[model samples]
Target: MMPNRVIAIGDFDGVHRGHQQILLQLNEWAASLHAEPMVLSFDANTKGQKIITDNRVKDWYFSQYGIEHWQVLHFEQWKEMAAEDFTDHFLKEELQVVGLVCGQDFHFGKDRKGNEFTLISRGITVKKLKSLMVEDLRVSSSMIRTYLEAGELEQAEARLGHPFCLMGEVCRGKGLARQYGQPTVNIPLSSRQLLPPYGVYAAWVEAEGSRYPAAANIGVRPTVESGGEPNLEAHILRDSPDLYGCEIRIELKAYLRKETRFESREQLFAQIQKDGEHSLTRLEMLK
Candidate 1:
């Protein structure tokens, strides 16, 4: 007999609302069959390619939604693996997956040969879900990425069912915010991750199980360093937890303004103060 499982296989890039739908159905099936909900996903990000969700954050979200078994397939190792080997060796022998779920557009294996029929041929049960629609738009990762690239945050968030977030370690900064006395956690943007436009945003920064409203800047310090890696600086309203070297997750709740170079430090400081107040007001509305 096959080991009990309801395996949902896909890139599941964003785990957007549509992806959640498949996972939710898998949950119901797993509960009914007394099986576990398992997810098999890729951990690769192509160069110059943007994704709605980065792999690190995606992994955490998967666990939060009750996925018991998580299998991350390294892109380099399995990129050339055949569909036959994938089923016989990986799924059958390795995972012992008895049931499968995926979107209608799901494709996998070498040369993108695997499909719904491929899994069925291996004698595994398969469920192919249709893409979900929201606001007359097909809720999809690619669509959401487009919205983010264009800085249409609210539209992207609507399809995502959550705010667009950036996750990184709070690195040491050049001590600009300290001059004003409130601590700002600086997060370096990874080249592997997708970025919204360089701008100021009303955000929520989460650290060590607590979330704080913040005014954040997503850009290199154009005023200070003419050229620098893209960095995200979030000034948590009324809280500073010695976040240096700490990992923090900042969700872009709303876009506030485009990043601009000020003629002087005084101008920048004044604008940041206004941004902090506006960010607080926006966050209050979220509550």
Candidate 2:
């Protein structure tokens, strides 16, 4: 028999404060119903935009909030399913879901037809949560994305209720930074991840249980190479171990400057030194 669950459903991208409300409610409903608390989210938004939160980040959010189970519905396969069929087959029969919680704006199934009313009509207990607001503005993943794209890290982090972070495995870059005696750990940008504006940012990079202040650049290395895919590389401000192959999380604290090209390698490294010190000062101010 399928395990009984009380599920909260949404794209849950970024798992912002608004999403937290639904999760918190799900816990309450599950306790009363004697069912497991779970979250059911799609792999992407219905509109198929780049994802704000990747799997590692989502795992961190869920774990921190005591969410026990997470199920991902592939958007491409589930998008066209009829509303009634989705409720009967997917929610009831497959997942054995006894209760549902979602934001008031939540919609599901073909052409976005399903809603809290639909769940009630189908005999499922439903909780429709109101949208979370900050400073009279709705806190949403889309709004956070806009803030990030505009290089407004402070605004985005305010809504997220946590730092806006980039999580990925450290990869070997072209060794140019090391050649200049300014080593950095590089993380390749995923095509599916929504990125902040290409620029230098004062950041905190977490790796192997330690956090270091860093100067992070997110963009093509215009000064070194003609053209390449954008990648994130951070120079640790203090002495650090080799981080290649380790999974790391870079939490953006503040934007420092836009990316620029310099005429010579000496000029580029000199600017990098200045940026590193500036980042240290900015991070200290944030504290």
Candidate 3:
């Protein structure tokens, strides 16, 4: 049977805390009206422009929040539809949507000619969400990206309601850390994936349902040699169990510092010591 009502649409790019608020509202409204809460998102490859989060990662986050009935629609054809036509088609023919929930800055249709007023005028109920403020600043996906690019993981997590994460299968590397008595797990990054600024960070490493506190580095290892491939390597704290060939998720908790080349191995070791201490302290505070 067709649900009598549906909460319509939004970009939902990162699915950060601000986006969560809108989803929660939709869930509440849907329950009150005995309707289904639907999330209309975009497939990363199909989106007209670049986005901050990939489709898989966005879907993971949404699933974590218990959102079902998710729809990842292609944006290319939708972008060509006129504002009114797009709304008429999606609301009436496709979804039979009775209401819509979206951020105040939401825009849609060709040239983004549609607004909350336009939807309401079409006899569709619309809820325009006010900007969500966190820590005296507006919480947004762009702001989160800025913080990540600047190596401000803590600040980004504050806005995201969780640590910034990278997911990939473990791969073999030069094994330099192992030679130096600190074996690590390395993950190769694809070009389309967003990387935190080159630096060390405090992180939580998760694989197959278990999580561990760890010290991680994201950079070209300038100390060993110059012009090498950039890599992400994490040294799981005090644990020596095998993780080779496993898929792992790394949650960046706090930025330690920018990648630096030291004059001697002794100096580099001393800096790593400081980073380890800082990582433990930050992880404790987060707990």
Candidate 4:
């Protein structure tokens, strides 16, 4: 016979701290009933535009949280199903979920007609996680995304329970920054992912368990030349080692300013010196 399962359901776009709490509760409930923990989430790629995180990031986050069993249900069929039918089919027949955990604002089923009350009436144990408040505001993925787009890294980090991070592998670049004495490790932009505003930022870069204070640039390299693909380039402070072909994670700590172009190479170098000085100051403050 299949093992009993305590199921948690959500889109979990960014899987922020509030979602972490709900997952913890689901784990606890599963342990109490000797059941396995399962996450019922939608398949990102299969859903196209509505999908949130790419599969790689989502899998990494869930795996880090010790979630071994994930049921990636297709949203197309269930999108129009009624609450009663969803409960009867996926919840009751397919998963045989004994306990459920979700955020207080979560809704399910056709027209989003499902609620905590409905789940309780169906005889399933239910736990409603309260919204996490940070600095008198509700912590949410949308709020974090807003901060990211606005280049408010510090505010976004507080709500995220950690720094906002972008993970990618170092790739080849035109090495234009080298001409200005500001060499950069370039990361290609992805259409499926949301990036912080085009700016210079104070960031902590992690590679192979090592972290370094660095300055990051996210844009189309307007200073060097315009009409190029967007890229993320990090210049590690006081350290210039080979990082080509290495996967790195950049955790943004604070926003410095938007990318700007200068009239001449000499002027650009001067501004870079200033950006470096400001980045160092911000790093010291973070420490």
Against the true structure, whose TM-score is highest? 2
Q: What is the C-alpha lDDT of each candidate?
A: 0.83, 0.89, 0.79, 0.78
Which portions of model 3 miss their true places by more than 4 Å?
2-5, 44-51, 223-229, 262-274
Instruction: Put the candidates in TM-score order, highest first.
Output: 2, 1, 4, 3
> Can you write out model 2's per-residue Cα lDDT over 4-89, one digit (the tens) per residue?
89998878898899988887888888898889999887887667788889877898789888896898888899889988899999
Q: Candidate 1 on 62-105: residue-level lDDT in tens?
A: 87788767787787788799988898888888777778888877
lDDT of model 3, residue 81:
84
Candidates 2 and 3 compared by TM-score, better number: 2
Tell me the tens digit of each residue's lDDT in model 3 across 1-287: 68756674766766788888888888888888788888888665333334556666677777776677788778776777888997787776778788888887877888888888888888888887888999788888778878878777778888888788877789987776677677789988666666788999998898888888888999987887788877888888756557889988888888888899989876776777677778888899988
By lDDT rank, best first, the candidates go 2, 1, 3, 4
Superpose all Cα atoms of candidate 1 onto the true structure and report the RMSD in Å to 1 decimal.
2.0
**Clash count list over all predictions:** 0, 0, 0, 0
- Cα lDDT for residue 270, candidate 4: 78
If scored against the real structure, what TM-score would every candidate get?
A: 0.94, 0.96, 0.84, 0.85
| Top-lDDT candidate index | 2
Winner by lDDT between candidate 4 and candidate 1: 1
**Global lDDT of model 3:** 0.79
lDDT of 4 by residue, 1-287 (tens): 77878888877767778878877888888898999999988755332533334555566677877889887777786788898888877787878877889887878887788987887888778888788888888887777778777777787777776777777788978776677777777767677777778888988788877887788888876666879877788888777667889888787788898888878878876777788788889999998
